[model samples]
Target: MAARMKRRDFIRRTALVGAGLLILRDPKSAWSYQANNRLNIAAIGAGGQGGGLVNIFAGMGENIVALCDVDDRRAAETYKRFPNAKRYKDFRRMLDELANSIDAVTVATPDHTHAVASIAAMKLGKHVYCEKPLTWCIGEARAMRKAAIEHKVITQMGNQGTASDGLRQGVEIVRAGVLGQVREVHVWSNRPVWPQGVDRPKDTPPIPPDLDWDLWLGPAPYRPYHPAYLPFVWRGWCDFGTGALGDMGCHTLNLPVMALKLHRAIAEGKTVVVEAEHSGCNGESYPKWSIVRYHFPARAGMAPLTLVWYDGGKKPPQEVLSLIPGEVPGSGCLIVGEKGMLYAPGDYATRWQLLPADQFRDFRPPAPFLPRSPGHHREWVLACKGENITPMSNFVDYAAYLTEIVLLGNLAIRLGGRIEWDAATARVRGRPEAEPLVHRPYRKGWTL
Candidate 1:
């Protein structure tokens, strides 16, 4: 076998090689078994969400040639599913060994590890589909965006709602002025169940034989293995996860960002200013509840809008919930506008209907359209073959959408005040004390 290649060097060559080779090929024909069309895929962080991604992609006829994860046991079952694929504990080693073969990579790791793994993969000229929130901090988010641009790799974030027909139509309706002048929007979810804001767990579990605890911790501080932090419950912790906002805000709260075209309003002071209020553990150790209010000057055609996010089993109110058909708001968003109201109390993939027909009969409910891509995983699988269409949750878009909500909310939770934000620069312009907390430091030997 040939000697392994460094990620940076591999990417530089791959970009020149892959672009020239892929540019002439038709994406529609790339999925077939033709010698020039087969795609080789690799997966990093094959545990909970990562394992699911592997399954989704493996079933899509792509060649899943590598699997990397810190835990052998959790990855064991996933590896068996792709028995022909090579497995490794570290993604860097996997990339080095499989550099020539891997055309794309899926990073389904924790929040803190997202940027590290994604940037490394993107640098190798491998198309990447990283999980939601993209990165733990705003700086990492920016870094990943830059790396993706520099490497010219197709990238997607795991905010699956973006691929949903309901969300697309909802956004279309909002853009078309059907929900005229959306002034106040409420986006929410049931999250932070991993027990944030509470003290660390008392019982430390011994590292399992099939697990590499140190590697799993990666850039996080040295903490003994605990059951509470593993097997899919890390969403609430500050160290490893990004709480509810980081967990679901990108999915649930994405509607307003897309519908209002908030990105275009940066020069007009029409930016996201989050007012975070009351954060602490619920029953278990979890910063389970946060009421974040996002104020935005309306995009040119609409009125100023205030977007509120509620998570951790918290409901907006009976009056607000009553606006929709069902008593339970569950895990979705409510858009309140001047002429009418629309309540979609669930994921965009599923049922999301406009409230009471009596409100606006002429207002035909928008068509619920499925995405052109096949789910989130396959979207990236297909994108690697020079197809420009990625999951609606592309990192450049999602990182901008998510980091603003999660990091700014975190600043409010930390500073205990509503800080005004300058979206152009992504900083709190008016407050001096709140400026330093904009980004957090990694433990060591790790960088955004």
Candidate 2:
């Protein structure tokens, strides 16, 4: 006689047996079984980057069940593609009405609305895939991490490079101590391809007929509709987006952040001081060019380090760029270590090389430590299905902490001085007046 299984194991085995029986009875039923397993996914902000995400997930075999966007005109292509999916202008209404139907949601709205939408979905027990910087401010990032923990839902931040094997290898190499006792990191970006350091547009254009202006302003203070803030120029604005650092830092900083374990250090109550020197910020948009520096104390047996960020056509000093073999790319990350330097060119850190090539021509990278991702979207989808896999950019593990660090640069930009940070208390020491910028006031009817 077969050994009796525990009740829990028996029930699980019985369910698997029943499912196998269905598959064996009819060949076509196997396909139907797959269809049933697909997640009922919804998308908020179904235009621009959101539309691209909707199609990617749908192509991956998830059922697109709903789409919400404030501008009908901008989302027309996606609407036409997923006509079967229910549509709405407001995410709040869509989530309320389809609370029972949605298994997961993808939030690709403006940075300011990311936390609100994601928190709402997580609260309803729906899995969430949110685009990066994850949140517009430090407080929202903390709230997002908390909500994900409290609700026990699958969550991924859309730092797609986290899926790259090259990036993972780079991270492994860094942590393996190839560059012994690293002390400095410099990251640069050529952003603000849009305008910055400028006054708000004086023209208040007529709100487009297909656009819901009130819904577009969700959680942000009221401002008249202007074309300048639409169709992707919002990155430069203070209220709607996180400017260049918030825009590209997640991608550029991912490699170093993962390898150095900076997030874990911050969580363990390490001191981080932030200061900035910029061309000049007018409180309306980011400066045309600026550099921000972060000072981190020693943690986890690693030496203390300084991270410097540049954006809006700014870059590391020429003496630093000379370390590279040829002309430096428009965007890149350079880590200076005591033994050698690791230079990764491009926003994703997908490709890299050790500097002073002759010194380490035959350097072999360490064996891979991080589990290779199947793909960024697939990782999240599989996690949502209760698979054992964990997405690398999940809110609690990575994105929230990254967002907090990225936004700290913004706070320094606004305050125009070095601000001592207390990570445990989430306070700016000796600058109570700057506290409000850490957590901005949301407009009426929205809460995180």
Candidate 3:
């Protein structure tokens, strides 16, 4: 038999062909795939949320060409379901071996690893769908956005709520001035169900044979294997996860961010000041309970706004909670406007009501301006198939901006002072000490 071609050589030889096939194809005919025009897709972190994503895309008829996970135990079911698909513990090896074959990739890795996996795929001109809040730090978020644009790949963040008609309608109403000059917003979550605000565990257990402990660590600093940080409890840890704000902010803050056009405001040189008061952080993990406030200057012909985020059972003042009929939701968002408040009483912002029901009992929503999404994952897949469409949470258009804003709050929490953000330069003013946290150092062999 002839020798097999090396992965690097194959990638270099077919780079242009791959780019032309995926990126420079005829736009009008991109989405014209027949019922059986299945895409060859791969998934990273194929367990937990990743497993659900694998099933969803597979259910949509795409081919599961390959799957990668650091923990084989967690990904056993997915592996069993797609036995024909190749498997690997290291994503780098998978991408190397299948570089020219994958049409798209879905990333459900831990927060710290998101940028590395997604950027690697995008650099090869593959479309990507990544879980929120997009990246572990502000710098990675920016880099992901830039890579998506440079590679000209279709991209979407897995906020999921962006696909809801109710969420879209709420965004339209708020933008159409139905909320009447909103200036205050409150978003809360019942999170940190995992342990936080505590010191790191001292015991170092033997690494599980089913787990590649170093690969699982990825870009995070060296830490011994521990059950305390795995199997769905890493969100509260600062090193591996992004805490509650990073976990839930992408979903809870989606509507308000879109409604207020905050992204555009930030782009146009407006200052976004952020500060936080928490239950006290020990530096190893996020605080158990905390509230963060972001102040945005008036922009785009709108009033200045204050967005306060609460987590760990803390909530807005009772006066704000009184607007709801019953007890305030364990997690919700309330936008206080001059005329009335727009209350979305859940994490997804899927259902919302105008507060002071008596005053707006006869109110009517403005005509819809935003086009509705064909399911969120479907949106990304269709776009990847060359549809003349853009996913609602496309990295270039929305996700990156949203992630940047959400992660900035973490900076405030870490530095224990107000963050005067200069969006143009992506820096915190007068806080050189906080700059390292904005873009953290990675272990050797990792590059964004």
Candidate 4:
């Protein structure tokens, strides 16, 4: 027999055990700050990216209240993962049924559906985390931004790379003038592969038993069923997806855009557009070699700089590569400044490196002074629970990012000429003919 422990000692030991449990189970505890509460999360488009996000939130102890998708096969898979979660083929129905139960929503849908689904969530006061490219068109991006602000709901864009500690650290270093006054930026990507520049499908394949064909094409034009358009091959098409610029431009070009805060520097009421050459794409609606050019306003104590976006799978010229070693580091950025240059890998997750052999061969980055951020989904949930602003690719940032890149590529696609863009008015200045392309009218039953 052993003597009974005193009440105070027992209480202290119990608390210590509880603390250990919290430390091991809750990764958010590792951070100095977190929302005092958990978020009730719902996912729209329960497929690849969306599924990954759901798993992260669920692991963090958030209630997965809803799962939405158009494809039956996709929905069935999602249902199996979180059987208790309410499932719906249409997002609108999910929002209607679970509006009161959901505190936030993660939207991972095709470019065409991003705006509609996200706008709906925001209007209902749900914090929204939408996938990259933001929207199918520049107009939709603008509208989504407006809706998010109007509803006073927290919002994030699903550019996961932004959440990486490496990304933010890189941004701070560049902003600190470690790389000097920057001017030109070169961003490249390998994308734009699929059924581009080809004749419309002449054969109508039988609709699969598990797919809701009409629902998948919602908002986008109604077309006969085709296997080429299904599964993951939609990226290359015009009506359903945003081509390569829309697909990879947001992710590849994000660093330069945010590091410089080019969006914030641009005049709120003014728009700048420059004429550019376009080719490539093998006849797809978007060009394979479309070079996007934008004149960004001066900021961070530097003069105005021209930002050029390269797509159609083209590599930067040798002159640009000369500043860096080993062939421009493949998919990365070349930032040429007055004093020095900076080179960052194209993969947004990679860290930024100073260019040229002469600059600090032995120099080391400053001590890791920043707190290690949790994965993307957790950041949004934590941000939503408190008054803190979610820093990752939120709707506002992604809206500006997508509007510029998507419109740039869209201007390239319009065969008439290199149309001028007005960021302020959200229109194409010198070309009234291009205005129609700026805003796409949705098919019936879709509301913005």
Candidate 3: Cα lDDT at 99: 89
Residue 45 of candidate 1: its Cα lDDT?
84
Q: What are the TM-scores, per candidate, against the unseen true structure?
A: 0.85, 0.92, 0.93, 0.85
lDDT tens digits by residue: candidate 1, 1-448: 0122222212211221110112211222222223245567789988778988888876776778889998888887898888898989988889887877787888988787887888887777777888878777776776886777676667778877766666666776777677667888887887765656777788876888888888888877788888788767777776777777877767777777766765445434445676877665332333657888878776656677788878767778777877776467468778887767667767453346665667665667545332444676666655555444444566654444555555667666656667777766867867766654556566787764
What are the lDDT scores of the predictions, listed in order? 0.68, 0.83, 0.84, 0.67
Model 1 clash pairs are 165-369, 195-285, 195-286, 196-286, 196-287
What are the candidates' C-alpha RMSDs? 5.9, 7.5, 5.9, 9.1
lDDT of 2 by residue, 276-349 (tens): 99989998888898899999888766789999999988899889998999889899999999999999999999
The lowest-lDDT stretch of 10 consecutive residues in candidate 1 is 16-25
- Please tell me which predicted candidate would have the highest lDDT against the true structure: 3
Candidate order, lDDT descending: 3, 2, 1, 4
Give lDDT: candidate 2, residue 260.
80
* Cα lDDT tens digits for candidate 4, 41-127: 889988777788888778888778888888867667667989988878888988898876777888888778888899998888777
Lowest summed lDDT window (length 10), candidate 2:
18-27
Q: Sum up the clashes in candidate 4.
A: 10
What is the C-alpha local distance difference test score of candidate 1?
0.68
